[model samples]
Target: MSSLTHTTTPANTPVERKATRSAGRRTSPNALLSKGVVNALLIVAAFYTLMPVSWLLFAATKSDRDLFSTSGFALGDFNLFANLHHVFTFNDGIYLRWFGNSILYSVVGSAASTFLCIATGYAFDTYDFKGKEKLFAAVLGGVLVPTTVIQLPMYLLATKVGIVNTYWALLLPALVNPFGVYLARVFSEGYVPNEVLEAARVDGAGELRIFAGISLPMLAPGFMTIFLFSFTASWNNFFGALVMLNDEKLYPVNLGLFMWNSVTQQQPEYYSLVITGSLVAVVPLIVAFVCLQRFWRSGLTAGAVK
Candidate 1:
């Protein structure tokens, strides 16, 4: 028995050496350390992003006096209701009008923009037309050019067309998103298979009917993505509103809030109203993302499989 044990012990040495080498790797724990570092960075990033938003939240709850007196994060006299009352009742409830205007602009403009983008992209993907590539190149070039750069040109054109200072002024400009067209074309290529379109064509389906029945449904994710962008742009269209509109009744929420904020220097009481209005303005954007994000996420694999 003792001789056998001694012989077995010599054979176990290689296995033990292998185990020891693995144990040495355990000492570094590189993967765990990497996860810890990554987690730390994410926490820091989250905190940094949330800090101002946190301040906005707590500040919104406070009265005008508490806003000045208390630390930004500290809870103060809960004047949220009063602030809301002031916001809605001020200037014959003009804030509500502004809010409604924003909703109309965002909803109408985004929907129209999304539809136009999907159609244009679908056509670009499916059809061969005269100078199509050159036309698309021009559209791509439009993406490179900043919207601000064309503001003057657009303003002059709108003036010539007699659409300035109108809803058309805001909505028309939003309809021509080069980036949305680009995204739609990509989505069309991936989501709407050429084979499916060919099959529809073989069935004697018209182009419009095929798009409405099949391709549009497949392009749901692209539509939502473009809509979100267009909606946000229309909602926050402060500079455009500033340039085009002189009528307070036609003002969108951002421009309305800006008008309120501009007066805060003289009328300090308007400060709370401005903050509360700003908070309210953010709600639609949040709601939009929360509602549509699932569609966007699920689309990544929606057509990837069968």
Candidate 2:
């Protein structure tokens, strides 16, 4: 007994060291492969989306001879100005009219529609009305229905009401986007806290006053999101415009370009004009996005966390 010395070693020490080492090197080949695949898909998608726009940029700068003669991506003679002059002057400067029409439809329609959607969404969220969820479910169902499905019906109704072939035909339908309503409802739930609304109401604020003062300020991000969506949709409303308006004066920039492009089969000169018009048509959207993208992104992020 005197000759033996007791010794004890902790068994868990070795195991803990092993686990630490493994944790430090835990990145797996499968995860790396998945990341690589996702990156590759994103690159492919970006290329597909930008390819046409890149072609338009190059094509817009070329003259008729250069456009057909050179490669689609090749630099052409610097004829952007000449092309633009021709585009503006052709048909008594009708391009300007189209631009103006687009501004009116996009700006005014978006403003009204965004407010309407926001108000409806706020009501759905804050107030406990009968059939509210059912009504909202119906609106969601409307979003699944393709817009083209309703186009003909909307056109017929507009015709019956004598608003077809006018700005009202396109403008009115844009104010009724079910998707916008859904988006607004989601945004309201996220951004506009019920506690704030209740506090305002308890302070003797009327419902309209509460919405206008407290709720509306909180819902700014949603407003901008809906406005941009509505504006872009109205700006590119080619099919609806085609069905409703025969007058070139009422054409939006997109439809105007389409009409010009249709003539390129017989008249090659229209190619440069159409390309240039298309490039110009893209400017408003770019500007709107640049100015408002942060709001949209913030809204989305806020909604996600909520």
Candidate 3:
């Protein structure tokens, strides 16, 4: 039995054992350290991003005196209702008009933009036409051009067409989103199948009918994504409205808030109203993202698969 045990243990000398130990220590320690560092960094980033939003929530509940005196992160007296009342009831309820205008512009303009983008994208993806590539390239180039840079030209065009102070000025520009077109085209190339289109064609389906019935359903999520993007962009648009609108009645919520902020310098009481208005303006964006987040995720995955 002692001879058999000795023969069985005749392997794994000191050098072999040392080498195995060395490899285990080298690989395991480095991998664990890397994972730990990554987790720490992610936590830090999340905290940094959320801190300001947290501050805003607390700040909105405070009065003007408390806003300046109290620590920004601390909860103040709950004056949210009073502040909202002032925000809505002030200036003969001009804020409500601005709110209504913003909603109208965002809903109408974003919907139009999404439809146009989907149609343009579908055409680019499915059809072989002359100048199609050039057209798409031009659209992408337009996306690279900042909206601020074209503000003067857009203003000039609006003035020439006598649409300058009207809803048309805002809605027209919002409808022509280059990024939405690009996103739609990319999504269509993947989410929409050539075989499905061919089958629809073989079934004597008209182009408009196939597009309305077949393509639109597949593009629904993409449309919603573009709509959200357009809505946010239109909602937050300050410079465009600032430049285009002279009539306070026509102002969107962003510009109206800016006006309120400006007047707060002269009339300090406007501060609480401005804060409340800002809080109200932000709610729609939050609601939109929450409602459509699932669709956005699915759309992204579908696009990636193609």
Candidate 4:
């Protein structure tokens, strides 16, 4: 029995050592140290990104005097309600008008932009039109060009068309998003199967019917993505609005807040209003993302799959 046991132990010793080494590697101090470092970096990044938002939130609760005097992260007197009342009441409630205009611009403009992008992209994906690639390349080049650079040209064109300083001025330019077209084309290629389209054609479905009845449902996620992108872009657009709008009534929330911020240079009392209004301005965007998070996530995942 002793001789048999000795032989078995010798044979199993190497296997036991190998298993121990693997287990050690998996739970090694170095591996754990690296993981700790990665977690730390992620935390730092999150903190950095959230810091300004946090400061804004805290600042909004303070009075004008407290805004500058109080510690940035510390809460001052709870005057959020008062500040909101002041914001709505100030300048005969022009801020509310600005907010309403922003809503109209973002919702209507983004919907238009999304529809145009999807139609254009679908055409590119499915049709064999002349100059399709060249036209698409031009659109792609537009994406690389900064909006600031084109703003002057667009302003000039708007002047030629006599649409400057009007609702059309903001909405029309917002609708021409090159990147949205690119994304929509990618989504069309991935999500819309050519076989399905061919089958629809075989069934005598018109092009419009195929798109509306079949393709739209499959492209719902993509539509949501493009809408969100366009909405955010339109809502936060300041420079274009600044250039196009001389009328205070036409100003979006961003520009409205900027106007108030500018005034704070002379009248320090406007400081609290600016902070509070800024916080209020951010709420719609947050609400949009939260409400559509499920659709947004699914769309992003579907797009990434291909």
In order of listing, the candidates' clash counts read: 0, 0, 0, 0
The numbered model that scores best in lDDT is 4
TM-score per model over all chains: 0.87, 0.91, 0.88, 0.89
Error of 3 at 260 (Å): 1.0
- For model 3, the stretches where C-alpha displacement exceeds 4 angstroms are 1-27
Find the candidate with the highest TM-score and give its number.
2
Model 1 worst lDDT window (10 residues) = 1-10
Instruction: Report the lDDT of model 4 for residue 13.
Output: 83
Superior candidate under lDDT, 1 versus 4: 4
In the range 109-183, model 3's lDDT, one tens digit per residue, is: 899989999999999999999999999999999989999999999999999999999999999999899999999
Worst 10 residues of 2 by lDDT: 23-32
Better of 2 and 4 by TM-score: 2
Tens digits of per-residue lDDT, candidate 1, 124-171, equal: 999999999999999899899987888888889999999888888888
Candidate 2 per-residue C-alpha lDDT over 1-306 given as tens digits, one digit per residue, 9 for 90 to 100: 379878998877988989987876677777778989999999999999889888888988887888888999997898888888988999999999999999999999989999999999989989997898999999999999988888899888997999988999888888898999998999999999999988888899999999998999999999999898898888888888999999899998888888888888898878888888888888899999999999988877757886
Q: Compared to the true structure, candidate 4 yields what TM-score? A: 0.89
Give each model's whole-structure lDDT: 0.87, 0.89, 0.89, 0.91
Model 4 lDDT per residue over 1-306, tens place: 455443344655888999989999999999999999999999999999888888889998888778878799999898888989999999899999999999999999999999999999998999998999999999999899989888899999999999998999999998899999998998898799999999999999999999999998999988999899999999999999999999999999999999888877799898888888888998999999999888787777665766
- Candidate 3 at residue 111, lDDT? 94
Comparison by TM-score, 1 against 3, better one: 3
